[model samples]
Target: MEDPRTDGAGSARREPEAAAWGERVARFVRGRVFPRESVLDGGGPEAAEALAALRAEARAEGLWALPLPAALGGGGLSFGAYAELAEAEGASDHGPAALGSAPLLDVTMLARFGRPEVREAYLKRLVAGEVRTCYAMTEPGVPGTDPFRTATRAERHPDGGWLVTGRKWFTSGAAGADLVTVMARTSGAAGDREGLSLLLVPTGSAGFRVVRELPVLGAPGQYEIALDGVRVPADHLLGEPGEALAIAGERLQLGRTLRCLRWLGQAQRAFDLMCERAATHDGSRGPLADQQLVQAHVFDALLALRTTRPLVREAVALIASGRDARTEVGLAKVAAARMLQQVADSAIQIHGAAGLGPDTPLPALFRTGRAARILDGPDELHITAVARRVLRTYGRAG
Candidate 1:
């Protein structure tokens, strides 16, 4: 007898092609790539080499640069398709970067504002994994949520060049990056947000220095960057002065979407692990899968996952359809990030003491989930924006 779930009646509910690709990626990672539990935590030159090899293999497999446009050697996936890939990669701790699947928040900015030559030179290399770049905007003393407080400065030199001077922190991927995309104040515009410009500075250029590879929570990778007179040709400037804020705004919107996609991936993995553990444990006399409380927690996590999936998908679709989803993207980011934290915490609860041990993946998953709330932007900030938008639309006083 034909199964009802496989018949034409259920064809409309078939899994997405993205899911199939995601499953392939997951299988490859679990079956072939990830080292055994003995060698998962530390970062070293050897780990870096292994990661690079994996990246090269992923690139070779026609899975490289999934977020990039088709003309640039990417899969030419729409936002929805790319989001699914991100979710898949996010399922494991190093899977995203190892697969060359880090969020390309500025891809839209590059497509819209970059010069033809700039796109050809930089974006093409980015797609090919020949170069890695990190964004430098946040400063040591400046409030991250306040963009107007940026202290980086760029002055036009007499010889048609620009000299940039600044210090930035929490610059992820900068340690191994070939280029740094810097935002600097280029003019004496009245407001803090005005007169900003984006510049591409090569790694070995004079006056550009990586001060240190920061150790965050004992994990190494993020870098502190110092631009003590970094000089670049006029052509290195990404867009006109005074347009940096707009570029950053657009990039953040897309970044939030990517964050949501990545978080969804991590949450999915955590939920799966929790369920597996629950089904097999015999210490409680009854399987955890049969516990009412455990079931409730699992159901809640699944509900959040189910809800946020569509929001993320919709945001991706809207972006691909040529609609700017700034506000919607923020909401999605906040929702997914908060939900991920809840899901991870619940998984830890379901796993009991095993969740706290380094041997289990839950601890690492929890750390990553915690970082998501602070990455891109804090959830409080997004909640504030969401509230303001709602008030303006529905408030009687308005």
Candidate 2:
């Protein structure tokens, strides 16, 4: 059979050069990077050193960040071209970070609206992986998808600074983050979207505290933060006081697209795992591959993956072309997230007890799949958004 790494809706549609670049990234991940999973996860000093060395190696091989501009220390791939490369890089959770491209969101946003001082201080460092940043938007009470419900507040100080006060949770990578882009109300009340602002709060501030780490699936990944009058310079404001929502929308569109690509890669990984199990695991009668029931699992996973792939690419392409892609992104978000969750479930079922343990990557991939549905935005939110958009089309016709 052909190598599954180069097989997909996105890969088939990609130009030869683009597809080859993506394939090279996949091969690098599968070979040089996959073996260093332990060092990446160790979260220790030694692991840090090893990961830094690995990033240097990956960069030297022209496999670094592919989505950002080349002027910003990236591979200069457009969103359309980066879609397939993202899939290859998504084969492992550490693939993007290890390759020096994980800060795409922050770097892109900084380049667009950041103050000169702020950009000088953090932008290059972020691209170089010298610092880590987290986005704090969800609070203790608001729905994660509703920016209007944010309870965080920022009060302007007399000295051209602001005192931010609020509590945020599920702030991913906050434990070690050097900075956080906090969304807080500067002029409007709760449930008002127009007054929200994004403030670049340095983690060393007196009141910017890391309350605790919130573990998902029994592992610590996200964090809770308490901003008790955290002071930030006036220039820390991103874009403008009332413009964060629009900026956030742009960032989220790109983020969701990247996630879809990553999820596709992960689903493909699970699909391969299921196929391997079916081919090798012999039961009472014969190899699982010979049994119709096992074949059903493989077929279903492939179907889900193949179907979701095109929808995701459609969304990515729309976003790439600067078109209004809310409907497409909503559809892709719900489908790709569900696809990953379902494929991971099937792969787990095929592996039985072995899939539950750490001996395989299935367990971790399953956790990511589950989170994919709820993170960024939940499936329910996207489903409603997509349905409403479709209904609007019918309304217009009628």
TM-score of each: 0.88, 0.93
Question: Quick one: best lDDT, which candidate?
Answer: 2
Off by over 4 Å in 2: 1-16, 396-398
In candidate 1, position 259 carries an lDDT of 69
Global fold similarity of model 1 (TM-score) = 0.88
Which regions in candidate 1 have their CA more than 4 angstroms from the true location? 1-19, 36-41, 106-108, 189-191, 395-398
Query: Candidate 2 local accuracy as lDDT?
Result: 0.83
Q: What pairs collide in candidate 1? A: none
Kindly list the per-residue Cα lDDT of model 1 for residues 1-398, writing each as its tens digit: 11111112222222246667777777756654556322434666667777777778787775665555556665555555556567776666677666655635545566677777777777767766677788988889877787677788889999988999999999987977888889888887424556788988887898888899877655666889999998887877887878888878777776777768778888887898888888888555587888889999999999999998888887877765657676778778878888888889999999899898876677766777788788777888888987898789875763
> For candidate 2, lDDT tens digit of each residue in 1-398?
11111222332333447878888899988887778876676677876787788888888887776555554565666667778688888988888888777888888788777888888888767877788998998888778878898888999999989999999999988878899999899997898758988999999999888899888876566899999998999999999878889888888988888899999998898889888988888888988789887888888888999999999989987876678888888888889888998999999998889989877789878888998989889999988888888888776443
Number of clashing pairs per prediction, in order: 0, 0
Give model 1 RMSD, 1 decimal. Answer: 6.5
